[model samples]
Target: MLMILLAIASACAYGVADFLGGAATRKAKVFRVVAISAPASLAIEGLLLPVLGARWEAGSLGWGAASGAASAFAFALLYQALSIGPMAVMAPITALVSAALPVVVGLAEGDRLSATEIAGIPVAACAILLVTVKRSAGVGRVRPKAVAVAVLAGAAIATQLIMLNQAPHDSGVAPLIVGRAVSSLIVLNAAIAVRRRIDPGRPNLGLAAGAGCLDSLANLCFLLSARHGLLSVSAVIVALYPAATIVLARAVLKERISRAQWLGLGMAALGVTLLALG
Candidate 1:
């Protein structure tokens, strides 16, 4: 029950961070937004480390670094895929792959699933697709290149989660600190490399920083949840993040939520409940 609550909290945090980051990107260059966000994430992780009582061992640091690198690649590819493809299609595919891969890895690593988990996973996956379903009007044929990139991005995201889960249970939040630090450096370097391409005018610094802080919190929750529960369950619950995103969009931006999305939200709730019960 505790793990389920933590995973749900992580999903909510991730959804909010994604919304903020997406908003920031609309007004600023992607790299610039990432520059602010990544460092902010690092800062939050640093602040949380001492409170979390991290051991900071080399093994944990190595796993964290690996996760960070994968995370950077995942973000880049996801953005590229979104830029080239219909988000309605790309987002669902990426979310499904990212969520499914972690479950597969966890099972392969000898994690057993309860009957409820077996049922919940598919329900959560269907909810993910439904929640991300946007009306892609006038969009041309689906680009194969975009699909490929989205798949790769999802795989990278799965790798990041798996690597973070591999960190020693005793390491506390050290993995998150190291991961955020490495990702921050990478994002900063990317920003510098394309400085000329970034917008020169004022950017949405507040949104970017807020996104980063929320993302750090989400990571911490996911780490704790995974350590305490089955990765299969935690990953699936986290993948339901798009439901929260849609809710926020409706409440804050007054965006219209489709009937399908409303159904998806209900399904997502049901899925999480089943996972929790399992």
Candidate 2:
């Protein structure tokens, strides 16, 4: 059950980190925000590595580095989406898609879930469509480009899980170290390409660094969670991260989601409940 707790903790931390990242984007370019945040996350992960008494094999480092590349791409997309759209809607859409892909892979790999769990798949799918319906000037609408990116972002998000889950059981924290290092390099390169300063401006510093730390911690929680539980189950719980971002939107941004979004949220909850039971 410790895995369950860690999964939930990962979800919560990710939610808050997404919220903070979105807020930081308002003050700086997304690339700049991501660039600064990556190192903060790396610092935390580095500190925790020894404290956790982790060790890894050479092969695991190679594989773990792949996860880093995948996650770096996914996070770039996620931060990009969060910077442009309503975080309340975007967060859930990204998470649901991320969760669904792994479950599909699990099924393909011969893992089975109960019938009730299977039913949740459709419900979650509907929710993804419903949640992306955005509003502008009192009109409800959806942007195809943003919607498209959101879906792609979800797929990218799933890669992080799929790759990390494949880490050699005895790999210790090697995958995490390699993964985060790769992500940092990606963000740094992106920032350079855009001529964006890697350091956050004074106003953006706190939010940027905080987001990075939380994100790093979230990844740690998920990795530890996977060590104790099924990846499918851990992914499901962690996918609930949107809940935290939604709360932050309402409280911090004073944003109200569309009615359709609320309904979608309900459906997502139903889906998660079923997944949990399954």
Spell out the clash pairs found in candidate 1: none
Can you give the lDDT of residue 231 in candidate 1?
89
10 residues in a row with least lDDT, candidate 1: 194-203
Error of 2 at 246 (Å): 1.2
Q: What's the C-alpha lDDT at position 124 in model 1?
A: 90
**Compared with the true structure, what per-residue lDDT tens digits does model 1 show for residues 120-213?**
8899999998998888786679989999999998898888889999999999888888888887788788879889887675559999999999
Clashes of each: 0, 0
Model 2, 57-105: lDDT tens digits are 7666877888889887897787677666675557667867898888777
Best by TM-score: 1
Any residue pairs clashing in model 2, and if so which?
none
Q: Which segments of candidate 2 are over 4 A away from where they belong?
A: 78-94, 119-133, 137-150, 196-203
Cα lDDT listed for each candidate:
0.89, 0.77
